[model samples]
Target: MSANLQSAANPSLSLKKRILPVWNQLGMLIILVLLCVVLALFAPYFTETNNILNILKQSSITAILAAGMTMVILTGGIDLSVGATLALAGVISVMLSNAGVPAGIAMLTGAAVGYTAGAVNGYFTAVAKLPSFVVTLGSMTYLRGIAFVISGGLPVVLQDKLFIFFGSGSLFGIPTPIYIMAVVYIAMFFVLKYTLFGRHVYAIGGNEEAARLTGIKVERTLIHVYSISGLMAGIAGVVMAGRVISGQPNAGISFELDAIAAVILGGTSFVGGVGRIQGTIIGVLIMAVLGNGLTLLDVDYYWQLIVKGLVIVIAVLLDKLRN
Candidate 1:
């Protein structure tokens, strides 16, 4: 009897150990499902296919931006300027396309501008030894101003059909934005999981001094990470522009907050050195679902913002306790 009990306990204990890390990833999924269940119980329209697809479509831009923000945050850094960079990129891309520039060239130009802005943030943080918060905060203001200056505070309408296709078209009955998000996430997952650069990012986030001792080029990696964040912001800008068919100078306001919220809700530690891409995905889904459910229930938008803020605060508090 004693031997049998020990044997059973051994397997159960081992199983528990294996499942510990997975709990973080599973937590978000469980919450999302619970929320959906509640919403479905209360609101019949919550289960509609169109409503679901709209949630996914609306989440596409934020998902893309959050994917990149995950990499940066995993390294114990944040980019508050992503919202401004996104707006700036959208304005530039649409303006260029309207000026008879080729669609491809206009897109590239926007991405380039975003990259440069990210590089500047990285340089100040990594090379100049400034805090990322201060650097990105300054950038947040400056970049938004730059966008207004460039667009003269006017909205830029895109005339290129190809650009609109990226935003509005469907592939095999799925929205193009959904397809883009899927591709970007897959590629980002591969890079984060398999590449040397990805490993370096983890190492640095895990411990910057230790990573330096391990011969990881800490400064360069920081720069590259910020650049990736900027690039994603640019991609998000393009997607948003496509969706709206116009580039508004004030576009993407407070979007950075949403991206960071998604990252945190996905189980990424603000303290640095711990995060999962899969968790981030679930986090994005939760936000999307919450928004969808609210719309279905006809809840006020202001209440939605308040709820989101509370969720972030709770998540960060829980993260602190876990650490």
Candidate 2:
């Protein structure tokens, strides 16, 4: 009788503990909802379905990049070159398509180029013992220069009708880009939760030396994590290019900052080894909401930048307090 009572009581305690961490994930969502409510009250147009879909569509690329960034950060590393890689990938894909290559082939080539860029970052950081921060930061500038040089600082356009569908098509009244984001997130969640690689990532972030001692193949894992980040940035570029029907050489400038902010706001620690995909999703939504709300309120663009910076600082402070 006592054992049965104890077992019943344990469920409630376990539930509470589980619920506590979830509150952080919920924080972004609550703020998003409140922002929407306030915006709708002030701007009647904010309640429109078109406006809502526009916000989701605009956020699609950032969400995709952030999803991969969440994984990279989990391994105690950062990829500052994502934005530059994104621009390069988009420019390359568009150039290929314009040069008589099939749209599909061009897209694949872009993804490959992006993956290669990631591999370079991984090699230097993992094998050469360089800090990821420094390696990616250097690559960020180099890659952006490459993008401009290759495209001659001009935009490239693809006239293929089918290729544009990936950006503009809708399924069951939802944008295709939004659907793509959903698929990516679902796959990422599984990879993070179920794979040996995922376990190794968390282990490495928790303690690289300890993980190495445990034979977790720390170098290889780090390489893979960064490669994934670059690949995802490439994917984002492709989607963005499709949406705009043109690849701008300077597209995705400063996009890495937004992605990193989203990851941190999702409760991922800069110190690493702690994060959740669910939280990332909420963080992405929060960013989308903030941007949308500001636009609806007619807030100055410069002020919006200030607000965003403040939000990131506050999020980091909160994360530090939690730790």
CA lDDT of each prediction against the hidden true structure: 0.89, 0.87
> Candidate 2, 81: how far from true, in Å?
0.4
**TM of each candidate vs. truth:** 0.93, 0.91
Off by over 4 Å in 1: 1-22
Question: Clash totals for all models, in order?
Answer: 0, 0
Off by over 4 Å in 2: 1-22
Residue-level lDDT for 2 in candidate 1: 77
Give the C-alpha miss distance for residue 304 in model 2, angstroms. 1.2
List the pairs of residues colliding in candidate 2: none
Error in Å for residue 291 of model 1: 1.2
lDDT of 1 by residue, 1-323 (tens): 87667758799766765677677658778899999999999998888888888889999999998998999999999999999999999999999989999888887888888888899999999999999999999999999999999889989888898888888877787889999899989999999999999999999999999999999999999999999899989888888888899888899998888899898988888978888887888889898898888877888999998988987788788678657
Summed over model 2, clashes come to: 0
Best by lDDT: 1
Cα lDDT, model 2, residue 6: 71
